[model samples]
Target: MFEFCADPSTLETGPWFACYLTNGVHLLFYQSFLTVLLLLAITAPVALAFGFAGAAASRSHIAPLRWFGQVYTSMVRGVPDIVFFLFFVIALDQALEWINHQIRCPDWDEPIRQGANFTVCQAAKIPLSSSPQWVHEVYNFGVAVFTFAIVFGAFAANVLFGAMRAVPRAQLETAEAYGMTRRQSFWRVLVPQMWIYALPGLSNLWMILIKATPLLFLLGVEDIVYWARELGGSRTSQFAYPHPDWRLWYFLFLLVFYLAFTRVSEIVLARINTRLSRGQATMAGEAQRRAGA
Candidate 1:
């Protein structure tokens, strides 16, 4: 935003390009990258927690709990991710609004489902219509995060369940031999060892999660993909900085960004795998031991 940028029309090539990139809209575009990063940061751990719960439930002695967990992982994993994304966000949104409507507008109840329209009272609207623009954006982003977590969580649960099973039965038996209860053995022996087995699957899930960030656009969060399309479109002379269609260039930048991000993720996961491999019986652990020797 140089002072000379005031007259975008008269500005030369360098100044025009500089001003174009530094404008308010471009700033928003830049901020959208952080939004994507934040989504990953929040969704990963939440999804992992969900996975752990589901995995544990699946392994539970109680039939109902085990069946519930099995159904959850099987159902969510069986569905196509995009279909789940679309259906779940709308369904979850309506469910929340329906709950709010019941609570806030109990007396004034015109049927919620009017052929195709799902109507709720004004007070029951999430974030409320009168809230700031940022409130709406935050709410939408939150919904996207939740939707991502649920879908990905099921896959993560499957990975974790397998990992939990892969832990040698002898280890648990040894814990029991030492007078540990089943729960104690699970926490002290099984949980600690499952990560090494889970890491590979979890790493793959991480990469998928990275790729999946673009789906935020489908959920109405104006993420990097949304901004890229918006900013990269051809602009007419009526606009401050007219340009031909540059979506190809914008998408190329995204391609580079994802490649770089995934590369770093690979490096990090490798290091973590090495760390987890130490003193374990896996091939990776054996390699580490030999290397150390």
Candidate 2:
């Protein structure tokens, strides 16, 4: 960013290092860390919301809704997660583009699926072909985030569903005895108490989500993994900053990043668990009560 950085190639070793770190591409590489954070921030809540809905659906009095929830939760559990991540992003993208094609190119005569190729109208292309590179990156990242949320949501649903069931039946009965309807008992009694039981599963899911952030690169997002590969490869004489192969160091950085993330998540989740157990009937709650007394 300094005026001396006007000619990066001509700069001395110290100046070269300074300019290299301050270069526009390097800034983007750094911001990719924030992108990971943003994905996690958005995905966690969306996934949890989906989980709550799925868990509720599983216990619905209506047979079809219950079946839908049960199937969703169970199906994801048996499948490899990477398979779902790959399949969902492509499937969802094609599905959206296909729908757009039908609407945008109503007069087009070509079939969408001709052998291996899946063609859509120019107007139906996501972000359109004319859009900038960053737009394409963002579109891909959005798809990746949504896919991650959906797949993880199923696992979260299973955890939440079991946790909801684990809430003591007598608590619901007591609410009913006080003239509360089933729905009221669920909302006022059961839902409030299920968190203590759910915390452990949800905590594990959070760590998994943290580790999975790197998969954003696999989905074509220009995330840290993408940048690491780009910047870490040995630069030749043609590039201003020539360096030796550093993929090992790049991946090592990634490993440390994820480990740090998981550690932070564990500390935060533990604090949340303590807060949730403040007045509950679980072992943690009982311990807290004894300590307070």
Candidate 3:
């Protein structure tokens, strides 16, 4: 901020605006963009791993394991993702704290639930109520990221399970005839070929994930949406720079950001699909071979 910013009321238009945008709050606003990217970077792979596990479990020969996997994948699909996000963060947090409380304060006489209130001993509080402010923020962001991964993972599992099934039965048969075991055939033939079938659904899931990043605001993470609402609210004479409401512009920027993110993802995924299809027997692969020849 400029030295002239000392007297915000005395500053002229450009100077006030300049100082306003350069303030510490604006730096936090900019960092929120990185937070969004961080969330995406962490969640995507975690969700994919969860999906892979779910899909593998759903295909298990053991009846109980298969039933559990099938139920998890199916029930998640039947419910709205946001509902799970809202419920799970609190539920998981409470579950963790309760378990911690039992171990850390076993002698405490008070029940965790006192009528409408769910209270735990101070020692058991996540991040320890004594921890720094940033610790709490980081803890909340972790919860949000985990919640997003779990909910989206189930959907990914569904798409991947179907994709795994879509790989031709004849291909597996051919691999077996070539002296491959069932497991060998699955890894060598089915797994490699299923990706093209999965790409379209996975692409759709990526777009949804991009859009869902805004829901971080609901989860108490100080994401771009949080900053947009905070920075764009009308500022009166009480604040450093007085301004009318600018929330619409802030939200519009968010809209453009998400649109660009998804657009780039679509282009990248398309290129990947093309590369993956080059030597396969699928329609796209066959078309490419014909064109090249």
Candidate 4:
């Protein structure tokens, strides 16, 4: 906070506004917006990769791998998202600590779970009990990212799997007739064409992913929502900055933020759809050709 903001008791509107916005916590609050964007940027590709692998495995000839992929893709739809978010963080965290406990606490033979408390040796503690604040934040962030990826990966798998199937079987047969093996045809023919079909579904998934970023709070990552709630509430005169409850204004800012981002996303996806449609056999491609002629 600025020196003028040190005592907000007598400050005029402009000075108070300046200090309130510049305060340390407010700075963190602003950065949390970037944190939301960063999570989406990092998670999208990773989840897509995971989805690709799952889709491929589901289509595999092998029984067990196919079953695993089917289960992975279906689980997201079957389980409620909020339930998954709440449960996965604790489950994943404990699972990580348990693995560490088994390796690091071999000499100590104590029940890992006693009543409601789960205990692991200090060595097994993630970010260790004595670690700095940043370590905790980083660990929490990692957990949030992993959770988001796992949940979204399943949805992506469903989209890609359908897209792969939408690729014309005749195209694959033509590749085979040219002496290409199944693997060769898949990479050279089917994979290339599936994107046209996949784009629509994946675009929808991207919108959902953007909307889902707010769930970062459920994972205990202090995200924009958390900050908005904290900063918008009434601040007593005893505090450095006294303000009436402004949650409505703060949330309105968030609403506009999402609306603008999603609007841009729609425009970008439209251009991509247009680019991908060119020369394809779809109606859109035919229209494009007619326009050019």
Q: Among these predicted structures, which one has the highest lDDT? A: 1
Model 2 lDDT per residue over 171-231, tens place: 8999999999999999999999999999999999998888788788778877899898899
Question: Mind giving the per-residue lDDT tens digits that candidate 1 earns over 1-293?
Answer: 78898989998888888999999999999999999999999999999999999999999999999999999999999999999998998898899999999999999848999999999999999879999999999899999988889988999999999999999999999999999999999999999999999999999999999999998889988889999999999999999889999999999999999999999999999999999999999999999889989
TM-score for each candidate, following the candidate numbering:
0.98, 0.95, 0.95, 0.97
Off by over 4 Å in 3: none
Ranking by lDDT: 1, 4, 2, 3
Question: Model 3 clash tally?
Answer: 0
lDDT assessment of candidate 2: 0.90
In model 2, the worst 10-residue window by lDDT is 213-222
Please identify model 1 stretches exceeding 4 Å from their true place.
none
Q: Where is the poorest 10-residue window by lDDT in model 1?
A: 106-115
lDDT of 1 at 292: 84
lDDT by residue (tens digit), candidate 4, 200-268 = 999999999999988898988999999999999999978788789999999999999999999999999
> Clash number for every model?
0, 0, 0, 0
The residue pairs found clashing in candidate 1 are none
Q: List model 3 lDDT by residue over 1-293, tens digit each.
A: 77888887887888878888889999999999999999999999999888877887898788998998799899988888778877887889899999999999999998889998989999999989889999999999899888888888998999889999998898899999999998898788888888898888988988889888989987888889889999999989788677899999999998898888888998999999999898987899999999999
Candidates in descending TM-score order: 1, 4, 3, 2
CA lDDT of each prediction against the hidden true structure = 0.94, 0.90, 0.89, 0.91
